[model samples]
Target: MRETPVLVRPGDADALAAGRHGDPFAVLGPHPVADGAVVRCFQPQAASVELLDGDQAVAMTRVHPDGLFAVRLAAEPARYRLRVTGRDGAVVESEDPYRFPPLLGSLDVHLLVEGTHHRLYQVLGAHPRAFDGVTGVGFAVWAPNAERVSVVGDFNGWDGRRHPMRLRHEAGVWELFIPGLDHGTIYKYEILARGGVMLPLKADPCGVWAERPPKTASLVWGQPPRPWDDGEWMRGRQRRADRHAPVSIYEVHLGSWRRRPDEGNRPLSYLELADELGDYVSEMGFTHVELLPVHEHPFGGSWGYQPVGLFAPTSRYGNPDEFRAFVERLHQRGIGVIIDWVAAHFPSDPHGLHWFDGTHLYEHQDPRLGVHRDWNTLIYNFGRTEVLNYLVANALYWLEEFHVDGLRVDAVASMLYLDYSREPGDWLPNRFGGNENLEAIDFLRQMNQLVYQEHPGAMTVAEESTAWPMVSRPVHLGGLGFGYKWNMGWMHDTLDYFSKDPIHRRYHHNQLTFAQLYAYHENFVLPLSHDEVVHGKGSLLGRMPGDEWQRFANLRAYYGFMWTQPGKKLLFMGGEFGQSSEWNVDASLDWHLTQYPVHQGVQRLVADLNRIYRTEPALHQFDTDQRGFAWIDCNDRDNSVLTWIRRAIDPHDFVVVAGNFTPIAREGYRVGVPEPGFYREILNTDSEWYGGSNVHNNGGVEAEDVAWHGHAWSILLRLPPLAVSVFKRDG
Candidate 1:
C-alpha cells in the first residue's frame, strides 16, 4: 500500500467526525491539494473505507476516531465511488454525495437571493433529479441562521453526521446531492442552531408529499405529474369565468362530506372522492366545488385552517397524483374546482415554520405584528421579500400544479388590517400610521396580478367580512384585485330576517331590500357558506321558523329568493336537504335525513332550482349588472310581500318574481308584468312536489292591458303562503 498523505486539516477532520462541520463539502469530498487529489468521507457506522477507481481499490486511512476516512489519489481527481465496510462486516458501494457539484445554478442563487423566484418550490426542496449521468436526489433548504444542517433519513440511519449539507451563503440555501437516494426516501433536516442547541428535526417546507399526521417527515416524491387530458376544459375556461355566467358553488369539507362509517368513520381517499364527489357535484348542477383547505395540516380539529406543509398534499388523502385525479374527474364532469388558501398565517408547531432557522425568519419578531390572536397562530412577515416570494409561489403552485380553477382566500380581512382582533394599544401601525397592512396588500395584489396573468382562466375570491372597498376591482384601479367578494351583509341580513317570526317580519323588511342598495359595488358572491353552520351555529334548516311544513316552506322560499337575487350563489354541504344539525368535522354529514319525504322534497327543490338557475339566461346573465334587477314593490311590508324583476342584457328576456313572506295564501293577488301576453309559471316553491300546499296558479295567467303597479300589463293569481314564484313571458 502507498503512503497516505494527510488530506484534511486536524480541525476540519474533527469537525466532520463530530457532525458540526459548517461546510461538510470542503472536507468530505474530492479535494485537490498541493501534491495530489484526495477523497475523504465521514461514515459513522463504517469500520473501514476503500476508494474504487476503475478496477483498483485504494484503502483509506481512518483520520479521526469517529470513522472519518481519507486517502490521496495518484492521478487527477475524477468521479469515484466509495466501498464502505461496516462494523458488522457488510460492504456497500455508492457514489460520494459531496463530490457532486451544487444542485442550484448561479441563476437560481441570484433569483432566490432577490426573492423573485416564482417557482421556488421546484428548486428548494428534496428533488429526485439526475446529475452528471447519475440518478439521485438533490436536497435543498433555506436556513440562514443554522450553524449546521444535515439530511437525516432511513438511508443514513437518521444520523446527521452521515450527510451534513453544504451551505451556499449567497442564497442562504443548503444543498446536497446523494447519488443513490431516490423517491420514497423519508427525510428531515437536523439543524444545529446558532447557540449550539439542536432544534427539532424540521420537515421540508417545500415538500410535495409528507407523512401522515403525527409522523411529520417529508417524502422524496419524484413521480411525474399527471398528464393533463382536459384541454377542452382549459380552452373554454376563461370564457365561462365571466360575471354573466351562472356561478353557483357548492362548498364542502371533503373529510366530513361523506365518511365511511364501517371503516372507523375515516374520510374517503382522494381517488374515491374523484368519482363520488365529482358525480354528486355534477348531478346537483353546481358550477364549481369549493373545498375547504386541503393542504397538509397537523390537527383534524382545525379543519385544515392551520396548515404546515404549504406545498404538500395531505397524506390523509392519497398522494398528489390521486389529488390530481380528483381534479381531473371533476373537470370531466363539467365542474370547476376551487380550494381555500390560508396565506395570512401559519401554526406554531415545532416542525413548522415557527422560529425557523433559530430566528423569526418567516414571521415578525414583534408579537403585535406577527401573532393572530383569533387563531393563536403566527402571521407571515409580509414585508419581508423572501416571505412574500414563498407565499406568492405557493398560491401559483396550487393553481398551476393542481389545475385548480380558483382560490378562495380565507380571512382576507385579517390580512388587510394590522389591528385585526387586537386591542388598540396591542397592535402596531404601518409606516404612515395607518391601520392598513400595506405589505400584505402589496403581496395580495401581486399574487392576484400574477395569477390572472399566468393563468387566464383562474379566479380569486376574498372572504373579507369588513366593508373593504372595491375588493373585486382590478389592481390597476387601486383595488385589492379579486374576481369576486363574498357578500357578508347579504348573508347576515337574509339569515337574520328569515330567523325572525313572520308576525315580526314586517319591521325587518328593510333587511331584504338593503342588499340591493350596493349590490353592484363589487362582483359579489352570496355565500351561505360553512361559516353559517359551524361553531355552535345550528344548520340552515334548524334556524328556520314555524313547524315542520312551514319551516320547509320558508327554506324553499328563502332558497328561491336567493337564487333570484342578482349575484352568484354558494351553499354549504347538506344545506340542500335541510340538515338539522350543526357541522362536525369528525363525522360525516347527516346522510340519513334524506330518507324522509320532507328532506327529500327539499333536496329535489334545490336540484330543480339549480337546473333552472343554470338554464335561465335572465337569472344569471346580468348578475353583476345593476340594470338586471328592478324593484316592482318593496313597500308592501303590511302584507309581508315583495315583487321584483330580473332582466338579461336584452330587456325583453326577463323573469318576474313575487315572494309572499307571510303564511297566508292571497288568492286574488295582482302583480305587474312587462308585456301583454301569456305569463308561464316556470317555478313555484309552493308546488306539492316540494312539500308545499300546492296553492299556485293552475298553469299560468294572461296579462291584461291594465295599468297596475306602474306596469303596462297585470296578472291576477293565487300567491302561496311563505312561497316565491317565477313567471316568464312565453307569448
Candidate 2:
C-alpha cells in the first residue's frame, strides 16, 4: 500500500493541516542555493533517477516510497544528463531529448522548493522590501506539462551538471528561488521528465532579453523610472472627439520612415525620429499617427508581427528610455500615437520565448492548438491561466510604459477562428466541434477589457478583414470590444472600381455606392494601408487604368471619393503624393516626385482633405453616434453621381456633398439640396491646387428656387465630373 505523502507548512500548523492533502505538490525547503549549486530530479512515476556523466549512468537512491529519487554531486560541473527507468527495468525516458546540439525538443521543468519553483523568476512579490536594494531578477516560462525543471545559464556556463534547479510547488505551480544572481545574467533550463526523458536547455517563454549566438537566455537589467514631462497631458486624457470630426491618420513604418544619419543609412533613432517625424505629421494636420509594430522582434522586415519580447521595446529602434521620450514628445505636440500590435502568433526562434523553462509554456503543447500552419509561427494557447496573465501583462505594459494612445491589433481575423486558413483534417475543433476559436475570442475580450479598464482614453482598433459582427461593439454586448474596425469592404470596392478604365468604371460605380448600406453597423476607418502597395499589387497610382493624364485624373477622382465617404481616413506613406513605384521598405519614399504637378496635386488634395475634415464639424459628429449622417441621393449610378448630407445634432447646421464620376464636366445639372438658399462651394477636386483643371466655382453661389420634384424649392448648379463639391447654406 502507498504511504501518504508528508506535507509541511512554513508558518502555521493549523493552516498546514487544512492544506496538507489538498495540494499535491509542496516545497521541501526554500533552499538558499548559489548560482552553480548542484541538485537532482525527483518523480513518483519513474522507478529510479540516474545521473549520467557523459555515457556513464550513476544510479540515485530512492528517498521516498512515493517515487522521489535524487542525487548530489560536488565535482566541477560539465555537460550531463539524467536517466530514468520504469519498474519493469526498461528505460522509461532520457534527459536531453534532442538528438543534436541546440537541443530543439527539450522541455523546461520547474523544481518546486520553498514556496516558489526553482526556475520561476520573480519581479514583485510579498517580500518586496527583500528586493528593495536587491535588484531581483525574475524569469518566466510557458511549459505546462513538465514534471521537473531547472535553470542553467551563463552564470553557470550553460552546464546542467554543476547547477541544477529545484522546483517548489505552489498552487499547482512549480518554481525555484535563486538569491545570489542579480541582473544581466544569461540563463537556460535543464528539465527532467517523469517519463525518464532528458531534454536540452530551453529559454524562458516570456523572456525580455534573448541572444542568438552561443545559445543563452536574455539578461534583463533593472529599469529606472521613465522620464516624462507631459504631466499635464496625462491629466487631459478623455474620450476622443466624435467620428465625423475631421480625422486624418498618417500610417508610418518607423524603421523605414527615415534612415539613421550615423550608421551607414540605417534607421533613425527614436529621439531623432520624434524630432523630425513628429513635426512633419503635426504640420500635415493629421490628428493621429499610426506606427507599425514597435515591439521587439528578431525579424526586421516582417513588419513587427513575430514578437518574441512583448514587454521589451525593440532594441533596433533605440533603448526603451529613448522610445518613452519619443512618445512623450508626440504627446507634447498634441498628436495621438497608435502602435500596430501583433498578438496573433510569435516566431519559433529558439532564443525567443518559445519553449523557455523546458516545456511548451507560451504556446499550446498539443500540435492542434499551439501551431500556426499558415505563417509557420507558434500560436499562443490563450486558454491557460498563466498564458492569459502573460498576454494581459504585455498589453498593459505597453500602455503603462509607452503612454501610447491606441493600438491597432494586427491579424485579428486569424485569432477569431480555430480553423482559419486550415484544411479539413489539419485542424482541431473545440469541445463543441465549432470552427470558432472560443479561447482566442475570450482572450481578445479579456485583453480589451483590461485595456479599457486601465486606460480609459485609449482606443483599440482591429485590422480584421472578415465579416465578424460586433467587432466595434461594446464589451457588455458580447462583442470583441474594439473601438473601430478597418472598412475592408470600402477598400476592396473602391480599389476595384478605380482600377478599371474610365469607360469601364461606369459599370462598376455601384461598388462604391453600395458600401453605405452596412457602413452604419459599426464605426469604420477607410484605410489605404501598406498591404495595398506591397508584394506586386503595385502602387495606388499604378492601379489606375489610363494613360498618364487620365491615370492622374482617375487617381485624383479616387481620392475625392475617399475623402467624401463617411469614415475616418488613413493613408500609407508615398500614397499622398502618387508614388509611381510600389513601396519597398528597403528604400525611401519618392520625395523627388514633388517636381511633378500631378504628384504635387495629390499632396495638395491630401492637405485639403485634412483641412476639409477639420473645418466641417458635420463630418466628425457622427463617428459613434448614429444620427449624424444621411444619404440624400443613391440612385444615380449610370451618370456616376452620389450625394450625401452631414448634419449636426442641432439639425440647423449642415453640409451637402455631391460628387460626379464622369470624365467630362457637366453644366446646369439640377442636384437636390437639403436647404434652398445660397449653396456656396466649399471644396472642389478640379481646382489647380489638387493637380486639376482650374475650373472651380468661385467662393459662393446663390441657388435659386425652382419647381423640380415634389419639393417646390430646389437648386440648379454646374457639377464637374471626377470632382467633389461641398456646399453649405448657414443662416
Candidate 3:
C-alpha cells in the first residue's frame, strides 16, 4: 500500500541529518500531526524503506536526499517495524528503538536525585530485557550535558546518526531500547556535546563487562539471578567475622602470584585460580585471601588499583561468571575472599569517568578538590549525590553478585585528609579550617553502615595509616565505621627494629613495645601487605640482621611474635615460603624457593602459627581488648628479650609468649606466669622442623611459688637463641 507523508521542520531536518538534535524525540519517530501520526525514520545507507505493522507493509516515501523516510498512519498509534533494503542489496527488519517508551521509572529518578538509590547499577546500565514482547538491550546513561547521545557499534556502523537516545530530563538521563541486541555485543556511547562539539566515544559507566584494554569499548552484558553454591558460607559468615575471630589474611596480586610459564607466561584464568588458589590458601591454614583489586583496569602495572570499570571484573583473568565461580570455590573450601576496593580516586582515562558528559560529573571541577597529585588520578566529588550512589552501589554489587566476604578499602588515608601528599599551600581546608575531608567521611560512613546492615557477615577494612580516631568503631559512636584498620605503625616499627643489627637492637626496644600504648584504639590487622615487598624493598627474609641461618631464625621468631600479637594478622603472597627477591609484577613469585628446606621451614612455621592462632582462644578472643593482654616482663632490655601473657575472656585460659632477640641462648630464664600449674610447651620456633637450632625446653615447665615480675608464680626454663616460645597453662 502507498502511504502519504508530511514535511518536517527545516531546522529539525538539518539537525537530524547532522545527528545534533537536542530533542530528537520531538521530531523523529512517531509524532502526532493534524489528523494522524507521522513516523519519520532516518537511514543514511538505505536504498528504500518499508513500514510493517504485522500483515500489512506500507512503502515509506523518501522525503529528503539524506535518507529521511516518513509515512502517515491512522490517528490511533500501532506498534510497527522498519524494513530497510541497504544499498548493498541486503535486507533486514527490526523494531524501531524510538517507538519504545522511557525505560527508567519515576521512583528511580527520585531516588537517584536524592542519592539514596543504593541499587543504581540495576537501572543505569545496558540490560537485555523483554520490551513489548520483543528481546532487546536497554541502554541508559547519566549525561545531562550532552546535546545528543546514541548507541554506536558494529550493528549501526558505529554511526552517531542512528539510534539517538531519548532524554529523560527529570533525572538528566538518556535511555533507549533496541530490539534484537543482547549479550556479547560491543558498543559505546557517541555523544554530541552542547554547542555541536563532538567528544570521544565514552564507555558505559555501569558496564558489568568490557573489552580488554587497548580495545576500549563497553560490552553489553547482563547478570541473571545466579544459583549460588555458597549457601553454607553465606549462612554463617557473621560469626566468622567477629572482632575476636582469627582473621589471618593471605594478600595476593593475581597477575604475579603464579603465572603459567609455558603459556607465554600469562596469568592463571579465574577458573584455574578458583581451584589452585583456594587449595593453596586452605592448605596454608589461612582464614581468608585478600586479593588486590580485581576491577577492570587499562594498565596491569597499576595492579588493579587504577580501575576504569568498577563493576566489571578484569577480563585479564576470566569473564564475570568465572570470577563469581572463583569466589564460590574459595567459599566451598572454607576460605573467605576479600577484594581490595578503591573508591578514593580514579585514573584520568579519557574513555572512563573523567569529564563524563562534558562536565565534572563524577569528579570535582577544582584541582585542589579533584586531582590526586601523587597518583596523577582524579578524586571523586564525594559531595555529589549521584557519585555517592554509584560508589556505594558498587560496594554492594561485589558482596551481593560476586559473594565476596569483605572489602579492604584501598588508600583510605588519602580520602580522609585533604592535604594528603600535598604541600602547605596546595590544598583546601574544610569549612572548620581543618584538613579533614568532610564529604568523604560522610560517604564512608554511609557505605559502611549500609554494608554492615545489608551483609551481616561481610567486613570492610581500611588501609588508614594515620591515627584517625575511632576508625573501626561504630558509626553511632562518631566513628568512621570500619570493621578493621591496618596497624601500620606496628608494621613499620617492627620492620625497622628487625632491620637493625641485634647488637644495636637494645636501643630500638621501644619500637617493639610502643604499639601497645594505643593498641586498643581500633580493631587492628597486623598487615605485612604487598606495599612492604614492592618497589625495591627486598623480601621480608632479606631484611633480617644476621647470617643466613640466623636470618631464618629471626624470621621464624618474628612470625611467632606477630601471630601471638594482640591483633589479627595478614601476610603478603610469597612471604610464607620466603621469596628471596623483591616482588616483581611482571613475573611470577619465586615459587622455586619452596623446594629448599629453609624456605619450606618458614612455610611450615607459618602454617603452625595459623593453627595455634585459631585453636587457642587466648590468642584470638581478646585480640581487640586490653583485658586479654598483660606485660610479663617488658623491661628486659639488657637481654633483648620480651615476654607477655595473653588471656581469653575466661581468666583460667591463658598463654605465655617469650621471645629471645639475640643469638645468645638464655638458659634458666625466669618468666612470670599468672597461675601455679604445669605449662605445656606448644610451639618453639627453634625446633628442627623450622630449620632452627634445637634449643628448647623439654616437654614443659612447672611454675614455682617464687614471685617474679609482679606475678604470683614464675617458671625458669631454657630460652632458644633468636627464637620465640609459646607455653599454655594446663593446670
Candidate 4:
C-alpha cells in the first residue's frame, strides 16, 4: 500500500480507485485549485507518472498506492502528455484520455432529445475519430436514467472507474473521447442504474459493427471511403420500381440458400454469395433479391427476425464494407437488393434493449403496450420521440449506408393494431378507445416518407396481412405510405384451391375466384414466400394433391397462373426447383433435388414465366389497374376451368390465359376471343420441354368470326390435363 497524501482526500481517492465514481470528470481532468491548476490521473498499471510540457517534466506525486497521481501546476499549460513507467520499468507516452472537450455538439443533442433527428447513427455509437491531431474512439449513448456510464473494454482491463463519460444533462446522453484508441477496438458501455445498482454491460444500440454472436461486444469502426458505382442504377430505379413495372422478386435466406460441405457446411461469405447469387438470380430473370432479416441477432434459429442490433449487419456473412460490396455487385447485375427489416418487436436479450438503463427506456412501462404475447418480445414505445428517432434512423442508416434498394417491413399488421395476437383484455386501447396503435401509425408514416424522400428509387414494402386501408398509398392521402403490400389473401386462397383433390376441386372452385374481389384494392405482391413452406406446413410441391406427375403439373400451372395474374411476383428460394422438405434454418436447402427432371422442369417453367412476364407489356405494364384483367369465363366450375384476358394500357395488346385444374384434357373447348385474328399459343405448361405428356396445340389457332361469350370472335382450343395455357393475338 502507498501512503495517502495529505493533499488528497481519502474518500475521493478511494472512489477513483474503486471505479464507482459518478463524476470521474470532476476529479480526473484539469481542475482549478486555490494555487492555480491541478491535473489528476488514475493509472493502475503505472509504477510512476510524469507530466511533460515542452520537454519539461513536472513529476506527479503518488497520492494513493493504487496509482492515483496528482501534480499541482504553477501555470495551466496549453497541452500535456503523460510519461508512464510500468511496474517492470517499460516507459511509454500517451495523451491523457480525460483532457478532451465533449465530442457531441449541443444542436445534435437537442435534436436527439426532441426525437426529430433522423440521423442519430451519425453521432451515437463508438466511432474512430481524430480530434486536434489525437486519434481515438468517440463514444456516445442515451442513458438518461443511469447514475454513471463508462467506456469499458480491453484497453482499461474492463475497469469502469478509469473512463467514466461526461453526461449532457439536458439530453441524457453521455459522451467520451478516449485518445489513442482506433478501429477494431471491442467495447461495451458499463452503466450504473439510477438507484446505484450496477447493471450488466450493454452493447451499443447504434453500433455499425459488432462481434458475431454469442459475443456481444461492439467494435469501434470508421466509415471507409469506398466509391459507389451504382449512380445510373440509382437514378433510373424509380421507373423500374413503380407499380406499372415488372417486379419479380426472388426471396432468399442467405445462410440456407447454399452451403459448402467441404467448409463444414458453413454458409458462403458475402463476396462469394454476391458472385453466386447474383449470377443465379440474373439467369433466372428475377428483378430483385429480398433477403430475410440480416440484422444482428444472437440465436441462429430466429433467422435474424429477433434482432438485438438494429444498426449492425450480422457478422454471420460479413462486415459492413463487405455487405456494401455485395449490394454493389448485385446492382451491377441489374438486381435490386431488399432486406427484411424488423421494427415491430425485439427479443428480450439481457444485453439488448430490454430493461435498458434499468428502466423501460426503449419500450413502454405497461406490459399491455410493451410486450408481445405471441413472440415473447418487447414492443417499442413509438410515442417516445427518442425511441421513434432510433428506429427511423436505423431505417435511413441501412438505406444510405449500404445502398439497399428496399426494406420489406416485417410484421406490419402487428404494428398497426394494438391487440395483435393478444387475448381479450390483454392489450391497451388507444386514447380514442380504438385498437389502432396511434403512435406506431405515426412512426410508420414518417419512416416511409423519410425513406422515399431521402433515397429516390428506394421503396418501403409492408408485410401487412390485414385489410388495413391504403397500405401502399401516399401518406398525404391518409395512408401508411408503403410502396407495396404482400397479397397474403391471394396466396392463401390459391394454395388452398390447389391442395384439393381434382374430384372435390369443383366444390372449392370459389376459393380461386374469391381473391379477385379485393385483388385491386392495393398494390400487391403475389408471394410464395418462405412462411408458406416452413414449420410443418411443408413445401409447395408437397401441398399439391396427387401422384408425382400431377403434383409437378399442378405446381407449374399455378406458377403460370400467378405470373399472368394482375400483381407483382415473389417466390422463395426452394420453390423454383420444388424442394420437397420444409425450410430448415440450420440445414441447407435441398439443392440436390434439382437433379430430377420434374424439379428441373419446374425451374425451367419459372424461367420461361419470367421471360414472358418481362417482355409482354400486357402482363406487367398495368398490374395494378382493373382494366389489365378481364374474365372471359370464370363460371366454368363444373369442369374446374377458368379463362381470362390480361391487357395492357392499349387494350388491343392482350394475352389470354386459360387453366384446367383436372387430369382430363379438354379437346375442342370453345374459348372466346376479343379479335377475329390468329391466336398464337405463346406458352403451354404441358409442353414436352416442361416434363408434360406431349399435348397438341399445333402452333397456333385462327379465331372464327362467331360471337361467343360476349365476344365477336372465338377459337376452338385443346386444353391439356392439369395445365395452364397462354395465347396472344397476332396482328
Candidate 5:
C-alpha cells in the first residue's frame, strides 16, 4: 500500500463492488478533498491498480478486499489514467470514464422531465461523442423504476459491475460516457429492477441502428451522413401531395416484392432497391409507393407490424444512411414514399418494451387496458406523457430524419376503441363510460398536429376501419385530423361485388354505385392493400370469380373503375401482374407471370391507368368535391352497367366512365352526354392490347342533340363485355 485511504467509505466501496450504486461518478471519480485530490477506481478483477501520469506509475492503495483502489495525490495535476493488472498478470490501460462531465444539459433534463422532448433520440441513445477531449459513446436511457442500470457490451466483456451508470433522479434517466468506445459497439442494458429482480437484458428503445434480428443488440452508430440531394423534390412535395392532385399508390411489401433466386432468394439491399424500384415505379407512372411497415421487428411473419425498435429502420435491408439514400432516390424520381407505422401495439418480446425497467412504464398495468387479445401484444399507455412523447418523437424520426413523405398509421381502429376485439366486461372504458379511447384519441390528435407543424409537405393517413366520424378532418374542428383515411367500406363493397358470379351481378349493382353515397365525407384512399392478400384472402386477381379470360377482364375493369373513382387509389404489389397465388411473405411476387398475355395485359392496363389519372385534370382535380361527379345511369341493373361523369373544376372539361359487369357486349347502346361534341374513347380495358375480346367503338363518336336519359345530347356506343371504357370530350 503506497498511501492511506482517506476519503473512501466502507459502504460506498461495498456498494461499488456489488454493482448496486446508482451514482458511481460520485464515488469512483477524482474528487477534491480537504488536503488534496483523492482518485478512486473500482476494478473487481484487478490484483493491483496504479495512477499513470504519462508512463509514470503512482501506486494506489487497496482500501477494500474486493478491489476498490484509492490514491491521494497533489491537487496541482488532477487528471490521471488507470493501468489495471488482473490476477492472471494480464494488463490493460484506459482513461477513467467517470472523470468526464455530463453530456446532457439542463434544457435536455427539463424537456425530458416535462415529456416534451421531440428529439429524444439526440439525448437518450448510444451516440459516439467526445467529451472533454476524450472520445467515447454517450449512453442514456429512461428507467425511472430501475434500482440500477449498467451499460454492458463487448468493450467491458458484457459485465454489469464494470460500468454501473450514474442516475439523474430529476429526469429519471441513467447515463454513462465510456471512453474509447465508438461505432460498431453492440450493447444492452443490464438492469436491476425496482424489486431487486434482475430482468432480461433489453435493447435500446430509441436505437437508430440495431443488429439484424435474432441477435437482439443495439449497435452504436453516429449520425447518418448529410448528402441528401432532394431539396427541390422536398420543396415541391406540398404541391404534389395536395388533395386535388392524383395519388395513385403502389403498396409493396419490400422483402417479398423481389428477390434474387441465385442468392438463396435473399431480399435486395436498400441500395439495390433504390435503383430497381425507382426505375420501375417511375416507369409505371405511380405517384407514390407505400411500403408496408419497415420498422425493426423480431419476427418476419408479422411483416413489421409488431415492432420493437421504433426509431430504427429494419437492418434487414441496410443501415440508416442507406435508407436515407433510398428515400433520396425515390424523391429524385418524383415518387413519394409512405411507410406503414404501427403505433397501436407491440409484441411481448422479453427484449422489447414489455416489462421495461421491470415495471409497466410504457404500457398499462391492468390487463383490460394493457393487452391486445387479437395480436397477443400489449397496448401502449397513451395516458403516460413520456410514452406519448416517445411515440410522437418516433413519428417525427421517420419524417424528419429519414425524409419519408408520409405515414399511414396502421391499425388505427384498434387504437380508437377500448373495446376493440373485446366482449362485454372484458374491457375498461374512459371516464365518460364510452368505448372511445380518450387518451389514445388525444395521442393521435397530438401526433397528427405535431407532424403537420414540424414538417411542411409530409402528411398522415389513418387505417381506421370503423365508422369513426370526421377521421380525415382537422382536430380543431373536433375531428381526428388525418390527411386521408382508408375507405374500408368501398374496398369491401367493391371486392364483394366483383367476387360475385356474372349471372348474379345484377342483384349487386348497388354495390358498384354505393361508394358515391359518402365518398366525399372524408378524404379517402381506396386501398387494395397487403391486408387483402394475406390470411387466406387470396390475391386481388384470385378474388375475381370467373374463367381465365373473364378473370383478367374483371380485374382490369375493377382497376379502371377504382382509378377513375372520386378518391385517391392504392393497389397491392402483385395485383398489377395478376399473380395467381396468394401472397407468400417468404417468396417474391410471381414476376414470371408477366410473360403470360393475360397478366401482361393487366400490367399494361394499370400503367395506362396511372398515366391517365395523373395527366387528366378532370379525373382528379375535384376528387373530394361532389360537383366533380354525376351519375349518368345508376338504374341499369338488368344489364349490370354503371355510367358516371367526372368533371374538372373548369366545368367544361369532363370525362365519362361506363362499366359493364356482364360478358355480353351491348351494341348501339344509347348514353347521355353533357355537351354536343366529339367524344373519344381514351382508355378501354377491353382493347386487344389489354388481352380482351377487342370489342371496339372505333375511335370517336359524335353526340347528336337527341334527348336521352334527360341529357342535352346522346351518343350511340358499344359497351365492351366485362370492361370499363373512359371517354373524353375532344376540343
Candidate 6:
C-alpha cells in the first residue's frame, strides 16, 4: 500500500484557507487511521493546529515549520479531534458534515466462503475478532468517496475499540482479516476520514440478498441447481419459413395473467404460470410470448422499470432457480420467451444503490445531465466506463443466466436524446449543443455489439418510436443492431383508422396502405402494446367503430388484415380473447370475458390464423426479401377494397389476400390474382367461427381464368364488407 504525507505550501493561500475549518488533514488526507502508524495533515491556510481530547484543547508543537502536524498514536483504539483556527480565529468541527448521532462501536464479522479460496466478510453489529467454529462471511459496500475503509459489522459487536480494520490502500478498500465466524452475519463499515470523522458504510449495490428496515442484512444462501430439459426440444422444430408469415405474438404480464378474487387474488407462481400459459399460448397459436419486465424490481406497480438489483430475479416471483425452471418449461413447449429489460434509468432508493459510497457513485452528480425530471429517477451517465459495463453485463446476465431468448428494450427513444421529455433550460446540451445524446449512442452501440458477439441467436428488439435511422441494422453498418423494432406507425395508424366512422375511413384508407410502402425498409414487428389498452384508451376490441355487431366485424377484419400484412405481430394480453375492459396491472387478465361469443370468436380466429400461417409458405417467407411481396391491386379506392399477393421465390408457392373496408357485402366482385390456376378459398374473415354473418365462400372453390399478364388471373367472388380473405392456388 502506498502511503504519502499531506503537502502544505506556504504560498498556497487556498489550501491554507481550506485547512482552518477542521484538521486540514480531514480535507486533504485519508481517514480511519490504524494503530502504530504515523499520520500527518498540512493546512497551508491554517494559522495553527491544536489537538483536543473531549472538548479540552491543548496546543501541540508543530513537527514541521510549514504548518504540518504529525502524530503517532502509542496504541490501538484512539479517538482524537483536531482544532484548526483560521487567521481570523474561525474554528470548525471535524464532524460538521456528519451531524447524525454517532453509532456504538460493537463490531461483529461473519466470514463466508463463496468458493475454495474465495472468502467474503459480512459484518454484523459491532464486536471484535473472528469467533471459533465459523467458516466464512461475504462483505460488500457502496462508497464512492471514502479515502480509506474497512469492514466492522456484527461479527465485531460494533466495537471499533478492538480489532480496528486495516485499509486496502491499492483498491481504495478497507478489510478486516477474520479467521473464523461464518455466513449469516449482519454488518456495517468503520470508515476513517482523512480527518477525525468516522462513519459506518452502506450495502453493496450488486447484493443478491436484501432486507427491509428493522431487519438489516439479507440472509445470503446458496442457489440450488435446477434441472432443465428443453435443449433438445428447441432443436427439433423447423426454422421459420418466412419472416412475414402471420407472426402473431401474445404479450403478457405474468403477475396479472391469472388470479382469482376468491383465492385472495394471489399471483400465480412461476411453475403455475408456465404450466397454464404454455398451453394457452400454444392453443392461441401465437408464435412468441412477449412478457412485461420480469427482472427484480423494487416497486411492483412501476411495471418493473425501476430496477434496483439487476442480477437477482425478483424474489416476489419465486426463487432464482424456479425462474430458470419456468423459462426452460416455455422452451420445451416450443414458445419463444421475450423479456422486457430497462437499462434507461433506476430508482433513487438509498439502500438500493443510488449513492452507496456517499458520492455520485453509480450516476452522474450534475443534475442537468443525470436527473430524469419526468420519472424523478436517476439516469445513468452512459458516458462512464463503469456504467456502460453495468448495463452490458445486465443484458448478458438475462440471456445466459436465465435462458431468456429475446429482449425488448423498453423506452429506447428516451435513451436516444439529451432532451428526451425535458424542456430548454431543464436539460443540458451535449458538447455540440445538439439534441442528440452522443454518450447514449455510444453506449447503445457497445451494448448491441457485446450482445451479438456473445449470443448470436438471441434476439434484441427495440421499442423505439422515433425514426432513428438504421436502428435494426447491423453495428458494422453504423446501425444500432437490433433484430427488430416495434412498429409504432402501424399501431397508431390502425388505431386511428379503426376509431373513425366508416364514411371518414375513406379519407384515412391511405393510413393502412402507407405502412406497406416502406414496411420492408426496416425489419418491423406490428405491435398492439400495453400502451394502447391503458389509461382510458380502452382495449383493442373496444377501439372498433360502429354498433355491437359492426364492432366485432371491424375487429375481425382488422385481425385478418394484421395477419396478412407483411410483418411480424404482437398482441397485448387480453387482446386474443377480445377483452372488453382495459388492462389493470393490479388484477388478473379478463379471463371471464372468454364466455362471450365476440370474445370466443376472436380467440378462434386468432388460433386459425396461426394454423394457416404455419401451413402457408408465403406469409413469413421473404420476411426481409423485397421480391417476396407485391400489391395485386391498390387503386380500388372507390370500392374501399385492397388486394395483395405474397409469393415465394420458388414461384410455385404463394397466397393471395383481399380486404374489403366497407360495411356492406359486395356480391360477385372480380379481383385480380397472381396465378391463373384454380384459386381455392383458404381463410375468410366473415366465417361463423369469427362471429361473422356466415357469408364466407366455401373452402376449395376453384377460380375461373381471366386475361392478365405475368401469370395473373381474375376471380369473380362474393366479397363481404369489413372482412378479409386468403386464397391458395391449387397446382
> 492-521 in candidate 2: lDDT tens per residue?
998988888666766887898777788888
Candidate 6 positional error at 591, Å: 0.7
Q: After superposition, how far is residue 105 of candidate 1 from its true place, in Å?
A: 1.2
Clashing pairs in 3: none
Worst 10 residues of 2 by lDDT: 97-106
Compose the digit string of candidate 5's lDDT tens values, residues 1-731. 22444658778888888877777888887988877788888888899998897667999888888888988777724467899999999999889888887778999999988889999998998999887777889999999899999999887778898888888899889998999987888999999997678889999998888999778899898764787799989999987888889998999888999999999999988999999999999988999999989998999999999999998899999998999999999999999999999999999999899999999989899999999999999999999988999999999989988899999999999999999999999999899999999999999999999998888698899999988999999999999999999999999999999999999989989898888889999999999988888899888888898898988899999998899899999999988888989999999999999998889999899999999999999898888789889999999999999889999989999998898989999999999998989999999999999999999789979999999887989998999999999999999
Q: What is candidate 6's lDDT per residue for 569-676, written digit by digit as tens?
A: 788888877887888988998888889887898889988888887667687776556677888777777777888888765787988888988888888777777566
What TM-score does structure 5 among the candidates reach? 0.98
| Least accurate 10 contiguous residues by lDDT in model 1 | 1-10
For 1-731, candidate 4 gives per-residue lDDT tens digits of 33234346678888778766777777886777676788888889999999988989888988878988988887676789999999999998998877888878988988997888888998999888888888888999999888889999998889887788988888989999999888899899999897778888999999888998899988987756599988877878888888889999999998999999888999988999999999999999999999999998988888889999999989999888888999999999999999999999999998889888889999999999999888899999999989999999999988988989999999999999999998999998999999999999999999999999988788888999999999999999999999999999999999999988998989988888888898888899999999999889999999999999999999988998899999999999999988888999887889998899888999888999999999999999889888899899999999999999999878799999899999999999999989988899999998888888867589789999888889999999999999999999998
Q: What TM-score, computed on C-alpha atoms, does each candidate reach?
A: 0.98, 0.78, 0.98, 0.98, 0.98, 0.77
- The candidate with the higher lDDT, 2 or 4, is 4
How many Å off is the CA of 303 in candidate 1? Answer: 0.8
Every model: Cα RMSD to truth: 1.5, 10.8, 1.7, 1.8, 1.5, 11.2
Candidate 1 clash figure, as a count: 0
| Cα lDDT computed for each candidate against the true fold | 0.91, 0.67, 0.91, 0.90, 0.90, 0.67
The alpha-carbon root-mean-square deviation between model 6 and the true structure, to one decimal in Å, is 11.2
Local error of candidate 6 at 44, Å? 39
TM-score computed on alpha carbons, candidate 4: 0.98
- C-alpha lDDT of residue 65 in model 2: 53
